[model samples]
Target: MKILSLPALLFSLVSVSEAKKFQRCEVTTTMRKAGLDLYYGYSLENWICMAYYGSKFNSGAVSGSNRHGSQNYGIFQISSRWWCSDGKGKTANGCRIPCSKLMDDDLQDDILCAKRIVRDRKRRMNA
Candidate 1:
C-alpha cells in the first residue's frame, strides 16, 4: 500500500471541495426549494436566467476583476467589492463571508447573500 503525501492529500481534498455546475432544471428546483422561486417578486425563470448568464450554472465560477478592481465569485457572481471579502483588499462585506465560501458546492450561503443583495436593491429603489 502506498501512502499519499500530506500536500497531495490536501490537494485532493481541496479539489473535492470545488463546486459543480448545476443543470438548468436542477437550478430551478433548488431555487424553488429554497423559497426563491418568486423571491423579491422575481419569477423562478428570471432567477434561472440570471444564474445562467452570470455563471452558466457553474457554482464554482469566479470572474476576472472589473474595471473597479473587484472580482465576482460563485454562481451568482456576487462581487467582492461590496459583497464578500477576498482578504487582500477592502470590501463592505455585505454578505459577511469569505469569497472562497461562495465557491463551495453548498449554496445556502450563496442564496442568502443573493437575497440580501435583492433586498438591498429593493430598499434603494424604494428610497
Candidate 2:
C-alpha cells in the first residue's frame, strides 16, 4: 500500500461517487437540523419544495448552464454566477465557497449560503 497525500485522501473521501440522493424524509430532517425550518421567514416546507423542484433531492445534480454560462449546483441549485465560484469565470462568490461544495452530500455550507442569498434578497426588497 502506498501513502497518499492528505489532500488526495480527502479528495478520495469526497469523490463525486460519494454524492448522495437524499430521500424526502432525510431532506426534511437535515433541513430542520440546519435551522432552515423557518429561516428567513420561509417555512421548511417552502425550502423542501424548492429543493425538490431544483434538484429532485439529488446532491450531485447539476443544472444546465444559464445565459451567463454558469450552472447551478446541488439541491438548492445555487448559482455559480452570483453565489459560489465555479472556477470557469469571475463570480461575485457571495457564498465564499466553491461551487463543488454545493454539490456535495453535506449541506451546511449550502444552507448557510442560501441564507445569505435570502437575507440579501430580503434586504434589497426592504430597501
Candidate 3:
C-alpha cells in the first residue's frame, strides 16, 4: 500500500480533530458504536450544532428573560410554552441526564433523533 505523504497525513489528523472538538461526548460514543467513523458520518457535527443552537449543550441551561416572558426548558432549550405538555419530562436531571429524559440528557432522544436525521440526509445526498 502507498503511504500518505507527511503533509497529507498531518492535514487529515487536523481535520478530524477540528471535527471532534465540538461534538458532545454522547454523540461521539453513539456514532462510534453504530460503526460510523469520521470518514463515514457528519452526524456528530450536526448534533453538536443543534445542541448549540438549542441550548449551548448546557444540560441544566434554562432560558428566560425579563422581556422574553417565559422559561425555556432543559438542555435542548425546548421552549415550554409551545411544547409544554409534549416536553413533560424532557429536562436535564439525573446522574448525567442522557438516557433518561429526551431533553435533559445530552444522549437522550436527541442522539437517536440526530442519527436518524443524519442517516436520512446521507441517503438523500447519495441517491
Candidate 4:
C-alpha cells in the first residue's frame, strides 16, 4: 500500500481549489465571441484590461470588503452589492444569480450578469 504525506495531500487540495486563469488573448477571443467586445461600447482591449485589473483573469477571484461591506466576484469582479447575492448581506441581485456561479470555469453566467450590469448602468446614465 502506498501512503501520501500530509503536506502532499494539502498541496493537492490547495491546487484543486485554485481556479484557472485565462490568458489575455484567450479572454479576448472568448469575450469577442460572447459579444462582449463592444457590448457597452467598450473595446476588446478595454474588457481585457478590466479583467486583468479586476482579477487577473482568475475566474475564482473574490475581493475583500468594499466601503459598502460588499465583495466583488469572478473575473470581472462584479459586486455582490448590486449584481449577485452573496447570502450574507442585502443585494439587489440584478443578475438573479448566486455570486458563486460567477466563479465557475464556464463564463456564460458571468457574461450574462456583466451585460445586465452594463445595461443597468446605461439606463441609469440615460435617465
Candidate 5:
C-alpha cells in the first residue's frame, strides 16, 4: 500500500479541529444571544451543558410519553396550553417556533427567557 503524505494527514486533522471549534464558537454566540452572558455568568461549556440537558439545544424540545399526552412544550417545557394563550403557538403571529414551538432554537428568545430565570434564581439565593 502507498503511504500517505504527512501534510495531507495534518490538513485533515486541522480541518476536523476547526470544525469542532466552529461548533463550539456557535454555541457560545448563541448562549450570549440568549442573555446567558448577563445572567448565567458561566463558561460556554456550562451553558451548553445546561441547555443540552434542558432541551438538547433544539427549538422544539418537547418531551412526554406521547405526542398529545400531557406533552411539555418548548425548549424550557413551557407547556403548549399555556404557550397557546401567550400567542406563542400561532405561527402567523409572533411565535418563534411555528411547528415545534420549542423556543430553544430561537436563540434570542431562549437566551432572554433563560436570563430571566437565572436572574430570578440569583435573587432567591441572595434573599
Candidate 6:
C-alpha cells in the first residue's frame, strides 16, 4: 500500500507567449510558396536574407524614411515612393497597391508587389 502526499506536484504549467513575428524557417517557407526561389536572379536564400535584414521577419514592419523620405513596409521593406502608395506623399504607384496592404500578416499582396518591383527594375535596366 502507498500513501499519497498533499505536496506532490502533478504537472507544471508552462507559459508561452504568443508569437508576433515569423521565424526564419517560416519566412523561407513562405518565400518558397510565393514561387520566388530563383525569380529575377534572386535565390530563396537571398529573399530570406532580405526579410531578416529588413524587418527581422516581422510582416507588419514599417521602416523609417530614407533620404528621399520614402518609407518601407512589410517583411521585404518595400518602398512607398515608387512601388506602393502610402498616401502620405506622391507615388508612382508602380505596384498599384496601398502601402498598408504590405504591412499585414497576409503576404500575398506583399509578394505580388515584390515581383512587380523586380520585374519593373529589370525593364528599366534594359531600357
For TM-score, candidate 3 versus 5, the one ahead is 5
TM-score list, all predictions: 0.81, 0.82, 0.37, 0.79, 0.45, 0.77
Selected candidate, larger lDDT, 2 vs 3 = 2
Which tens-of-lDDT digit does each residue in 7-77 have in candidate 2?
A: 78888798453468999999999899989877878899989998999899998889888888988898888
Give Cα distance to truth, residue 67, candidate 5, Å. Answer: 16
RMSD of each: 3.8, 4.3, 15.2, 5.1, 10.9, 9.6
Residue 47, model 2, lDDT: 91
lDDT of 2: 0.84
Better of 4 and 6 by lDDT: 4
Off by over 4 Å in 2: 1-17, 122-127
lDDT of candidate 4 over 47-82, digit per residue (tens) = 788889889999999999998999999998988988
lDDT of 1 by residue, 40-125 (tens): 88788877888899999998998988877889999888889888999867789998999998998888889888888888954421
Tally clashing residue pairs in candidate 6.
0
Give the per-residue lDDT digits (tens) of candidate 5, residues 59-104.
5555663344334444444444422223433222123333243443
Ranking by TM-score: 2, 1, 4, 6, 5, 3
Ten-residue segment with the worst summed lDDT in candidate 5? 15-24
Estimate the overall C-alpha local distance difference test score of candidate 1.
0.84
- Winner on TM-score between 1 and 6 is 1
Which candidate model has the greater lDDT, 1 or 5? 1
